[model samples]
Target: MNDTVPPPEVIYVDTHKVACNGGGGALGHPLVYIELGAEGTAECGYCDRKFVHKDHAHEYHDPSPRPEGEH
Candidate 1:
């Protein structure tokens, strides 16, 4: 039995900071704000949704690691 779970939903944002409400109306969790900080990536604690900055989108896709501040 090799059941694989899919990755969490990803959202591309223009800013480094964002707020998430789960997007499920009454079923959604409380609104929480996240800061991407230096890494340029943040994930929602309530929904595990990944928020990636548009400028750092390449880091999320490319597995190879490169120099920092290059992206």
Candidate 2:
């Protein structure tokens, strides 16, 4: 068995308030609202997906590399 661990998915959100339902599909879960506190990041309790504030995306493990001042 492969012991390598895959990286967690990171979503950059513009607003502090966000709703997650496992992306809404066959593997989706109940709709839930998540708030990004002062830390500027939140993880879905059901899916474990990481939501990072767009302004602080660089601070997290974001796959996309964005230049300064650019969303």
lDDT of 1 by residue, 1-71 (tens): 74744336778899988999999688799989999978788878889877889998877864333578653
Candidate RMSDs in Å, in order, are 8.2, 5.5
lDDT of 2 by residue, 1-26 (tens): 86744335678899999999998999
TM-score of candidate 2 against the unseen true structure = 0.72
lDDT of each: 0.79, 0.82
lDDT of 1: 0.79
lDDT of 2 at 60: 73
Instruction: Output the lDDT of residue 33, model 1.
Output: 90
CA lDDT of 7 in candidate 1? Answer: 39
